[model samples]
Target chain A: MHELTVDLGDRSYPIYIGEHLLGESRWLQPHIPGKQVCIVTNETIAPLYLSRLKASLDGYQIHTVILPDGESFKTLEVVNRIFDGLLESRHNRTTTLIALGGGVVGDMTGFAAACYQRGVGFIQVPTTLLAMVDSSVGGKTGVNHPLGKNMIGAFYQPYCVLADMTLLGSLPPRELSAGIAEIIKYGLISDYPFFEWLEQNVDRLLVGDQEALAYAVERSCRNKAEVVAADEHEGGIRAILNFGHTFGHAIETAQGYGNWLHGEAVAAGMVMAADLSWRRGDISADELARVRDLLVRARLPVTAPDDMTPARFVELMGVDKKVLDGRLRLVLLEAMGNAVVTSDIDTDLLAETFAACR
Target chain B: MHELTVDLGDRSYPIYIGEHLLGESRWLQPHIPGKQVCIVTNETIAPLYLSRLKASLDGYQIHTVILPDGESFKTLEVVNRIFDGLLESRHNRTTTLIALGGGVVGDMTGFAAACYQRGVGFIQVPTTLLAMVDSSVGGKTGVNHPLGKNMIGAFYQPYCVLADMTLLGSLPPRELSAGIAEIIKYGLISDYPFFEWLEQNVDRLLVGDQEALAYAVERSCRNKAEVVAADEHEGGIRAILNFGHTFGHAIETAQGYGNWLHGEAVAAGMVMAADLSWRRGDISADELARVRDLLVRARLPVTAPDDMTPARFVELMGVDKKVLDGRLRLVLLEAMGNAVVTSDIDTDLLAETFAACR
Candidate 1:
């Protein structure tokens, strides 16, 4: 197993990556606060892996909440279901909540854990590549509101994240592509060397190359951990971690949350942000093209949908959590492996960039 | 105005107590993050004081969300209404939420502020004595669930709390009595002198004597502020603040939320806790009697309803937030001004205490 630390001082925790880390009871037992544990999973993953996960939590009072799969169920009402399950099982603040599915399960379960008795211990057992590489690491837990995505949430850190790469073999082809977008995002925002490495290893990753997948998950977690450590609350330096999120979140909100996967929207959003950077003379047009080429090679969308307009995009971006005061501060690229947040970009130029992407 | 600091370092805020403090624009304006402010009040309090509060926020883009009164409305659904109103008004992270009602308003607004963009600035404009003396100062914000009261909440502090004594003049007699129960609680759990003062000045406070009411509000806030500053998350020192809450919350939960005021249930619970303490040889019969006498004088209930049985009370207390692991750690009195949390108390003694209270 490979371990990466998110050094958030007292709030710091470790992320474990390996072929089958979920099979190791040692990794999860130390973090369990009590003998009672509840594993929150979804319909898709439960039938396949719930019993396997239960084996690791033997000798503990285990309960399960099986929710329907999809972003459509990520609501306050769904979060309440998790809470009801915990309360009915008589789970206390000391009880641990094990999120045993992909990003939706991890996000909703983390949110439920955050608000349950003001917060309890929760562990992430990511079953999808997207969750393993990104969402499972950071403490950014919340559900989407009708007006926007991730509008209601808390900056709650998990006790530990168990990202077993072995689970990636079961993910659908489309979902696997979605996960690669975020994996590529880390390299684009912070690590140039990793971007070059992914270019060479893309085919290996697609074929379930175990070593390549492990390396990708470890690097992604390390990059995320460093960013989270510097800005636990997304104050300043942490905003860089949201490179494509401004455009990405708007797309998610405009498209109706479940219509498009988060990673797909973010993949398209990154290409748009890169083009906007090129328009601002911050990056070469070649660099922008390279970003688009890489996303295309990974089978991810690199352009905005035809129906989405600049005006609609602006309206959706208005409600984003990143908007401060009234100005829309976006995390734009200066170059690949580098980013900056700016509000001084000309509105006409941004509109033109959006038009080009569409 | 008299000011007391909550002393949480950078996150610390001041609690301002005085007559007509709500109209003091200078004190409120500096804390509001931007030029826009949203005041959240209920229908009962809005008609009486909205104009004065609005006059204080003259330059800001002021908005009001007048919700229906009562604890039943303190649900996530109501919290979302405030979120919807803020979004419609183009309120961003800079927009401040001013809670302008009793405990229900303060809780819902504070919770809405906590979850809006992961959290925003909140100012408590507490009009009811119950809110002024307890809920407004501690930063314990949440909405009620069908299964429990305050089951969903966060310990997010306000930027400031405005306790305006003048507004209490229009409060109903029953509500005023309910508020005094909490005032008596500060004395029961931590302050003997405050208890003596209440015994001497109960009539004066009931009739709205400015000096006596101010003293009660200030002392109760002082006690709460100190406990909150010491243990913001109810780890250990803060649990003492819930001296009668375990039983009280159970009563609120079983009787249906809004059937009895929080303070009323707490009043009856304190008497029960005191009786239990005496039965366990933790306090003398005279001390228990003194506790009941003071509650009776305040026009608060000193006993549970005759229909409530020890078994039902046991079931209710089992689900309380204070329970750790599987043991119920209740805050029991050792004297008029001292309390301790323990799970080792005899179950038979507890049953007798509940029977005596009934």
Candidate 2:
């Protein structure tokens, strides 16, 4: 087992990565301040792991809320089901909520915990790679609005995040590719060597090689934890973490939420951002090719949706959280393994990238 | 204008208590970090003060959401209206949400600010004495759940709280008395001298005498600010600040929210707590009589609804935010000017208080 702490002072918590850590009460119990436990999972995840998670929570009052599975279900109305379950079962201020699914469940449950009784304790037992690597590590918890993705939420950190690697064995192939998209993001934004490492071991990770998967998860979390520690609220350096997210959110918003997975949209978005970066003379054409080829090799999308128009992208991107004071700040790569948030967009270059990427 | 800071470390904000401070942008602009401003006021407040506020915010992008008035509308569905207006208007994270009504609007707006794009800056322009003195200062922001009052919320403070005293001139007599119920709460729970002052001047405040109202608002805010600063999340001593809330919430819940204004419910709830305190031998019969008399003089309810049975009280109180584990922790008077949270109640004594208070 490998462990790393997201150093947030008093709000700091450890992320444990290992095999079959779900049934172990030792990793979860310490963070639960009270005896009442509520497990929030989705229909797909609950049938697979709810009983195991509930078994570990023996001797405590337990409640389970199984929501419909998918990105489209990630809304305030759906999240309210968790609140309904908690209140119906008499979960008090000290009760702890355990999120047991992919990013959707984790996001909704963490957000529910953040709002329940002003704030309560919550632990994250991520069942998917997308969550274990990106969403679960940061304190960003929220639901999607029709207008934008993650537009309604809070930065409420979990007490602990238990990423049991064995759970990934059940993840679908397309979902696995989605998770790798975020892992690749770490390399593009901050760690070039990891990108190189992923280039070499891309096949092994694709086949669910245990050792390769463990390393990817650990490294991704370490990169995320470091960025989050320095800027918990995304005031300065943390904005770099959303390297492809601005363009990706536009794709997600354009395609409708559940149709394109967040990671898949981000996968295509990174390529779009790279195209613009090359046009800005920040990265060479060869470097951009390498970025595209890596995601292509990993079985991820390398182009924006054909149906999405430039005008649509502009309208959607304008409403993204990254937009400040009417200026659209895009996180672009200054060089391979380096990113900067810049509002200095050349409209001609942007139009060309939008035209070319599709 | 009398200004005092609610010292919450870096999250601290000033409460400007005086006559008509809302029209002065100096009291508001410093807290607004961006050009976009959204004023979340109910229909009742918008008709009264929205234009004056809009005039003050001349140079900024402004959007207004006029929620329906009264406590019944304080729900996640209604709060979502604020989110809709924010997203529709493209109010970015830096946009400051100005809550321009009473406690319900403040609670909903603050909660919306806490969740909008994870979090955003907000300023409170509380028009009611209840909001100006108690709810607006404590950083307690949330909407009520069907099962309980304020069962869901966040401890999000505003950048500044502008308590415009002159706005109270337009307040209805019942609502004005409701505000005084909270003012009297500050006196009974923490300030005996203030309690004596209220005893002598309750009539003056009831008649809207500016001097007496300002002094009461200032004193009430001071008591609350001290309690909130010491325990921002209600960890320990802050629970004392919820002196009559447990019983009061039951009454409010029993009456279906809007029927009993929050303060009216609290007024009755305080008498119930005083009754219990006298039975517990924490206060003399004379002191308890004084507590009841002050609320009556202020034209507030001194007893629970006749239709609410003790069984219903137990059911509702069990789901309160103050309940830790399964134990019901009641905030009771330790003396004339001090409060304590205790679970040690003789059922017979509790039954008698529940029976006798009605």
Candidate 3:
């Protein structure tokens, strides 16, 4: 197992990446500060890994709530069921909540823990490739709204995140590819050397090469940890991490959550962002082609859906959280390995880029 | 206007108490970091004060969400409406939420702001005495679950809190007296001098003596500000601030919310606490009588309702947020002016206290 720490002072927590970690009491036991344990998982994952975790947490007063899987279920009302179970089981402020599933389960459970009794101790046991490299590491826990993705939520950090790579063995091909998009994001945002490594190992990553997967997950988390440490609340630099998210959220919301995988949408969003960046003269045509080539080879979408018009995309992106002072502050690429969040975009360029993507 | 600060490092905010604060853009405009502002109020306060505040906040992209009045409306579904309004209005992360009602409105709005896009800027414009002295000062914002009061919430601080004393002119007699219950709480927790002052000045406060009322409000806020600043998240000293809350919450939840004003339930809860403390030899019978006398004179209920059985109170209080591990922590008066949260209590003493209260 490899370990990394997100240095957030009093809220700092460790991220453990390894194979077969679900049953390892060493990683799961220490963080729980209380006797009552509530493990929230999805229906798909419950049959696969619930018993393994239950064995690890054997001596505690354990409880489990299996929710229906999908991003569409990420609502306050569904999250309320987790709260209801906690209350019914008589879980107190100190009861530890274990989020044992993919990104959807992790996000909903993290939010449930955050709101339950005004916050409680929680451990993130991410089972999917997307969740292990992204959602589980950061403390950004929340649910999505009908009008927007992740519209209502909290920045409540978890006690720790346990990323068991063996759990990813069960992820479908498209799901695994979606997680790789985020892994690719870490490189695009700041590390050219890592981006080059990913480009070289793309084939190995796709064919279930465990060593390649481990390296990519570790590097992505390192990048995530550094950025999260510098700005826990996204005051400045953390916004760079949303390079493709502004466009991607629009895709996810417009397409209806769960209709398109988050990674697939983000992959397409990154291509659109690259196109916009090139139009603004920030990146050369060669760089934009390199970004698009990567997404296409990874078997992810590289363009907007046929149903989306420039106007619809613009309207949806208009309400994203990145908007500041009534102007959209987008995380745009300055180069292949660098990005910046700026509202200074040429009106014609933005419109043309959307038209091109559509 | 009299102002005091809750010193929580960078998250610190000011509490402004005076007459007619809604018109003062000097205090409102600075904390608002964005052009968008959403005023969240209930049906009772919207018609009386919304237009007045809107006039002061001229030139901003303002929106309003007026909810049904009362504690019964404090649910996740109801709070979701506030989120829906913000999204429908296209308000982004920088949008500022100003809660312009009593404790229910303030708590729901603060929770909404705390969760809207993982938090946004929020200001509290308290229109009730209970809110001014208690809810608005501390950053404890949440909604109620059927099983418990404040079972779901976040400790998110607002940018600032505005307490308009003149708004109290419209408050009913029972509501004003209920607010006094929390005012009395400040004294019982750690201020015998303030307790003595309230005992002597209860009649003046009840009769709407502005000078006396101002003194009581300011004093209550000072006490609240100190406790909140010391603990922030209720790790230790802050729990003392919840002296009467356990029994009070049981009273509130048992009778169904809105039936007993929060402060009214707390008033009876305090008497029950005093009765328990006296039984344990922590206070003299005379001291207990003094506590009961003030509550009776304030026109607040000094005992639990006749219908609540000891078993029911125990069952309800068992699920409260304060329950740590399997033990229930009761905040008992150590003396006339000091209190402590202790899990150490005799079983018979607790049952007898419940019997006595019933």
Best by TM-score: 2
Q: Which candidate is the best by lDDT?
A: 2
Better of 2 and 3 by DockQ: 2
Q: What is the lDDT of residue A278 in candidate 2?
A: 99
Q: What is the DockQ of candidate 3?
A: 0.83
Worst 10 residues of 2 chain B by lDDT: B317-326
Identify the superior model by DockQ, candidate 1 or candidate 2: 2
Model 1, TM vs. native: 0.93
- Interface RMSDs of the predictions, in order, are 1.1, 0.5, 0.5
Model 1's CAPRI class? Answer: medium
lDDT tens digits, residue span B194-267, model 1: 88988899999999987788878989999988888888887798888888888888788788776888889999
Over the stretch A1-358, how does candidate 2's per-residue lDDT look in tens digits?
8989999999999999988889988889989989899999888998899999988888999998999988889999998899899999989898999999999899999999999999999999999999999888889999988877789999999999999989999999999999999999999999999999999998998999878998999999999999999999999999998888888988887786678888999999999999999999999999999999999999999999888787677677663334534378889999999999888787778878888998
**True-structure lDDT of candidate 3:** 0.89
User: Regarding lDDT, does 2 or 3 come out ahead?
Assistant: 2
**lDDT of each residue in B1-358, candidate 2, tens digit only:** 9889999999988988888787888889888899999999988889889999999998999999999998778999999999999999988878999999988999999999999999999999888888888888889999988877788899999999887888999999999999999899989889999999999999999999987898899999999999998999888999887888889988976887678888999999999999999999999999999999999999999999888777777677663334535377788989999988887776667778888878
Ranking by lDDT: 2, 3, 1
Displacement of the residue A86 alpha carbon in candidate 1, Å: 1.9
Which lDDT tens digits does candidate 1 get at residues A193-287?
99889888888888888889999989988988888887888778888877887888888777877677888999999988898889999889888
Estimate candidate 2's alpha-carbon lDDT, on a 0 to 1 scale.
0.90
DockQ of each: 0.58, 0.84, 0.83
By how many angstroms RMSD does model 2 differ from the true structure? 3.1
